[model samples]
Target chain A: MNKAAASNIYDILDDLPLDSGQVLTGAQIAYETYGELAADRSNAVLICHALTGDQYVASNHPITGKPGWWERMVGPGKPIDTDCHHVICANVIGSCMGSTGPASEASDGAAYAMRFPVITIRDMVRGLMALLDGLKIERLHTVVGGSMGGMQALSLAANWPERAERVLVIASTARHSAQNIAFHEVGRQAIMADPAWADGDYYASGASPDNGLAVARMAAHITYLSEEGLTEKFGRRLQNRKSKSFGFDADFQVESYLRYQGSGFTQRFDANSYLYITRAMDYFDLAEEHGGKLANAFHGTSARFCLVSFDTDWLYPTAESRHIVHALNAAGAKVSFVELSAPNGHDSFLLEHEQLDRVVQGFVE
Target chain B: MNKAAASNIYDILDDLPLDSGQVLTGAQIAYETYGELAADRSNAVLICHALTGDQYVASNHPITGKPGWWERMVGPGKPIDTDCHHVICANVIGSCMGSTGPASEASDGAAYAMRFPVITIRDMVRGLMALLDGLKIERLHTVVGGSMGGMQALSLAANWPERAERVLVIASTARHSAQNIAFHEVGRQAIMADPAWADGDYYASGASPDNGLAVARMAAHITYLSEEGLTEKFGRRLQNRKSKSFGFDADFQVESYLRYQGSGFTQRFDANSYLYITRAMDYFDLAEEHGGKLANAFHGTSARFCLVSFDTDWLYPTAESRHIVHALNAAGAKVSFVELSAPNGHDSFLLEHEQLDRVVQGFVE
Candidate 1:
């Protein structure tokens, strides 16, 4: 796949040094721009996409043919209004959405596949910084992200405080909890367990690990929704049937919903990318990066931080946001935190939330 | 594979009718008895095992060579006290453990596999009732179970009201919630997704869906533990290493633990049984069986009910137990409900807890 020809690619001038002490040569970052940048470039707002997200933040997704994931919040006159801000959303380093990922060709003219260096949230942030340099935007007006994207936002604030004047993180954590790591590990195992996976060398085999990846997606989809939300939305409702089938066919509405989600995901996403991106998330520990103190990560940072969390987001609960707020407070950084009530769990950030829009608009403006 | 020779097998004299309207021509109920039945059979206590549990209530598991799952709760002078009560535990139908399940021989002398009719929680209770009748026990002193086991106890109380005088349900729900069904569906999909599964006819193929089953177990294992308990137990700790492997190995201790759990489970469990059992659990909705009002299930019941829930058992939380308690209260039944503090989540029922032991001992004695 020629990623450079498909999207706006910014080739890094130097070798990209990774957290694992490996170097990525001739790295190309794929990104999409929503609005024009100001003459001074101070109006630029860099948006980091989540694990499964891509560069299409305010437009239609090229693959899915659906509206951009954050289209509701990032269009013209919207919350992160493209009218005033030059919105730039980048496909993260380890992702396969036109980015130089595992599916990308190596210098040896073969897909890197499993040879792709294990990247971290910080490494992803470094990639973003390189993209920013390539675009000649020395400082972003704000850095905005949610979930894995939010991790990148925090990483930018900690590692490159001068890159952004404001930072907004939603429904994310500074470090992956033990449960979080365990869940990711389960997903990784599922993907690798597939015979079609071929130890991540399936790109040339024409047979992807769709079964394992679908199962992995199905498992992850449950964690994205609150129990109350699921109960209200699905309950024990039968799926287009009068009664239970008493067989393995999707009898419940939830089962049908999950099966759809699992199968639909395999179409637009790469299985190897799922492995690499989830690995990056599991390795994300902001405090560990700074000498055993979370506050130290934000030392001397001038970026005004606004952290938003949902009450029912058990995946990255409100406590995680509070932990970041506490760290920011200890570091004496300008910070504001809010735990909004939402029925949709961790996916609340990507959904239609008026309160979240208000917070993002208020903080960014 | 010889279930009859290995355990106390009671071949049902009559055809066993299932909730799905399917009938088993030759059904066998494998059970283990502790202590002897009283002269009037009034001292009999029937214990139903949960998902993945067996009839080895107070003895070692024959397959795993491990101590009985509920050995701590049922023994000489233990909580249930086999010294005074003739304890009986039968592996539920649709389960692999020496019961007439998917792996069991069908009427034509071949493994049922996917050919086995789908069974429900009520269906399982019916098999238990047949077992009781075969033993010439008119009524039991108590019917006790936790998790899926608890579901069976409630079913017996509702359907076979005169079979047991007392019902003790722990860490279980009267209905399978949307979230519950969703998780179970993921597991079922995981197992079915494996190529080696071969539509559940792998009994003759000699290749089991261990990878798929392991992944399924790994996903389910997370729900059985509280986030706090996981943090306290593993907490991002590396597994026998000083630092992250930066690769697809079990780096964290929780990953290692889950991997161990997943692999160990496949060794002792049949993959087809996992699919059938989880499907049965997903189909379990007591209120639906009783015309949408949970209280209707317990109407005119004479059994004394004791409901126990753990503070951290998110799978079947205290609210689920309270729902049952409310229904029992509305029915004007003799019922007692307690929500105990435990950090182990849904698996707390299987873990040793002093409070639980005391409650069981006091209630039984």
Candidate 2:
């Protein structure tokens, strides 16, 4: 894959300060743009991605050779409408996709691996803001995100209120709940437990912890879909052969599907990136950052807000979106909230929905 | 760990047949009895345990030196009161803890390991039936179970209707759903993915898939508790630290608790047995065995059925119990189903509850 066509890299020559009291040196961000920047540069929209999602929001993924995850929503005439607006999607800093993450290099030219400074969602937003600064975009027409992306959007609104004129968050939460942290912890533990992980230093060894990473992906993938969705999609159906295998060999169709997702994910994702990104998500607490009041996060913010949640998105449920809306209301911010009905869970944000399309179209217009 | 004080072994010298058309020879079952059988041999109540539970229902666990799992609900004057009835709890055939499982010895004088025949929930019931036959018990007054144990109770009532006069199933389904199988599959994959698992042949090598098994337990453990319950109990609470560790260590209290649960589980549990038992649960589909009709499973059964489900038990939700109730209604059988409000998710059966006690007491009486 040609680098120019795939993504553009922006280098932050100054050391980027981190919340963990560590400074990241030679930080870089990889981003892709869908539409040309308007002459006034006031029509630019920034799109943030979820965990495991990359900057290829409207382009083909280089490694997977598949259409972008949100291709249906982001192309011309789509919900995101790349035709009229300048659309940009950047790989989050702590992610593997051409970003300055654990898989990136250190000053000594060695892979950072576990040595990379632990970054929070705020830190990731800071990286994106630097990218925005490099592109000479003074303010975004809209900043839209879902799940972790939503976390970043909220972070941007709270920390840098004037950066975006409009903030759209979907299927996301103001903070990670205990259950949320617990699930992510399971994935992290699974990755760490694999012998091949080599304490997150497996990059030099040339053998990634594919098994552990796959298992981690498998576990996380289950949470992304609703139980009803899984039941409808797979049921208790067998994988290939009829009847039960009576052994531990992916007997059920869901097992086969999960196994496929896990293994396929390993081919395109780094285990260390999984660790860093999940950790960042776990550490996210907008209320805590704003001194124990969620409303305080949105205080003195002039950005118009739009929040959306899916009925089946238990990862970050409708209640979480409502919680954010209440905070926005308490802060006296102009915000619109909607809970869409979708069979898919947290993944609904990435999937097609007429209501979501209309909402985005209206909000952006 | 005296044998007499802990449990008794019942040997079935005859070749025991499995649903898979395989024969298991020299099968032994480890069981414990609380209180005494009545003169008419009709006061016996068979208590089935969930996954990871053993025969020590109301007594102390030999390995962990802890009170029995169901001690709160099974002792004198408690629900399933041992004072008024003979309570029999057995470690299911495909389980560890002195049962004939993957850890048990084969005729070749080696641990069966993966060579052990894949057994189903029905096969486990068959082994229990053999144990009852050896004990010269004409019938049990009641057959009670929760979770995987509930699967066995349903299996016993369907396959051998005359074996028990009453069937009590709690927090379980007649058949595992796609989501159920997916979760079990995750656990199995976690175990098998471990290099130490050695394809379930790690017994002779002195290394077990503890890490994988622990991860499996951690994942499954999350499902056993409700989201609200987890939030109430842990809620981003730190683990013996002032703030986030900013590293891969357990930062949240939930993560710390899960890690402890995972690591501590390895000390007393066998990983291969985990695989076998979960496979058995996945293979369970009452409708499939009953001519593609759930009602047919209870067609000739005379047992009074009592199905209990916790409102918060998402693993085996109230709808699953309602499904069984509908089948019982279709079969013209007397059935009582109740969705108990409990905060502890699927673990409500083992916890103390006045309502559950009333139901168990009234049903058993």
Candidate 3:
């Protein structure tokens, strides 16, 4: 089957209310499912994706022709065990992957573009809740996520306490820090700075702000990897050359690698979507939403929470996970926390890590 | 005096050879001097400036109309003791402020731009040495620098051991880490991605890549600051407004601060100069240059060395200083190393710190 046939999109019958005081009508959510749903829907596992991620959790990516981002973690007999559990990954709103986003048509049959209302993490979770309601799955076996995905998982646990029985958050934060917001702001500025952006109305111009988006991606890419990991992987080794070019070329292997990442991202991701999604993440503050106490967000929650953090993930360090664990403890929730030693940093969640796999399998089972 | 008069430009009377096998003729070195030189010239102290620094080390900046970048540390009663020592700080060759850089006029009477030969840290030190020779000074006292300036100090100590009796390197690494190169590459790519950049020939366009350059500065500025410092200073604080605008305005204080920094940087710095200087820093590898052994770089050195690093500095961490100390020990050189506790991160050396002040005073004395 082609990408369209393989992808399942759910159209919301009701208008979606956003934190920005705006309402979204005719919203569509794109998702992919693996395995079969149990008769009572008790074996359904909902997976949320991070920024630049989509719903292809355990299948082939239609755009890149690469395996699902979490193909290693979620498959038949894998950590998530698709053989026994039904896996569902949804593309959040404000994204361009067949979802109702800036690129999507409004009631007037035109792209929303800059007219799209700003969204929050809670709003994304609301969309997931709506998806669950549409599928007639009252409660999920588990809600799994990492990074931005983790934020969504936490949001669901906090706002819709009865939606998921288990919450698995990895390398995530309850709120965006000043540094995190600053990085996202830099990316937003980069995308807006490109003339080709045309104020996010470049859909009909047959041109997009690829260059600015690429630069933004490059900056964000650095934060995803540990310094030691980068040193081990690239070092000061020249890129396909014996000596430095002494020019503007990518002389170092790290430089070449970053360029590839920056450019490759532009192909599958939309610049406007990047801006909107990052903005949503920056505005994420669970404590603020719960009367300025993080524990209050998890009040009366019976969900079994498992939080995993990588020792080297500076983007959302172990401290962040510890903060959440403390909040969960104060809420008197049944929670398990672990800081796994990993060299890959914040991206360790999607990369190969036997320890992480073991943790996921143990927690899920 | 006008900025031109306050800035002293020295014309090198000889051709300068560079590491890239390129020869530069008619090189001009701009400098600012403080205090009077002793009759024996033994009281002369050479202060090397960092990547974006210029000759106005202890004086008013020509372009910014602000105090000198090092006014806090280089006055008469300061650590360097300008009262007893003739202090000289020269702008690096690849910088814009009154120095021979990519913005300078070529022999053909046009801006060198991208046509300028790529330079290295050692090449910058060579320019400083030539400036010293033109001043009829043998550099008897010391060479003090921080960050990129520290690289130049180390380079001078190794390549021209007889130039100075003491070398003080603060918060610096002997070589660029892979992470460092990656960040620099992001900045460079950001600049190059701008259509206004015009392949570095934007000098005559009346429109420089300010947007791209600003984004680059914003990205680099993050590395100069510690995450803790950012949190303490601007943790999720809104900018001027009580609530987010729900739009692409600078809603957060950190975003506003970054935009201010990025935009302010472009007003005084040339985009081409930034590219050249950053490229020079990335190519710096003291060990690779000296027979693949860091100890060899300091072999037979009679110069007294002192290295200071900040505990919060992730850019050039204390471990980097330790590495240098280890090599110095193996080379049988007299070296003292200190990692000061500071909240400012890599920019700690340029900030006010009693401990750093005491160390500088104690070492220089």
Error of 3 at A363 (Å): 1.2
Candidate 1 off by > 4 Å: A1-5, B1-5
lDDT winner, 2 or 3: 3
TM-score sort, best first: 1, 3, 2
For each candidate, what's the DockQ?
0.91, 0.88, 0.89
Instruction: Encode model 2's per-residue lDDT on B235-262: one tens digit a residue.
Output: 9899999999899887789999999999
Instruction: Give stretches of model 3 more than 4 Å off.
Output: A1-6, B1-6
- For A1-365, candidate 2 gives per-residue lDDT tens digits of 01122478889877888899999999889999998789999999999999999999988998888999888888788877888899999998878888788888888988898999999999999999999989999899999998999999999999999999999999999999999999999899899999999988888787888999988998899899999999889988888888777667777889889999999998888898899999999999999999999999999899999999999998999999999999999999999999999999989988879999899889986
* Clash numbers, per candidate: 0, 0, 0
- Among residues 3 or more apart in sequence or in different chains, the pairs in candidate 1 whose N, CA or C atoms overlap within 3 Å are none
Ranking of candidates on DockQ, top first: 1, 3, 2
The models' CA-based lDDT, in order, is 0.91, 0.90, 0.91
- Going through the candidates in order, state the TM-score of chain A alone for each one: 0.98, 0.98, 0.98
For model 3 chain B, the run of ten residues with the poorest summed lDDT: B1-10
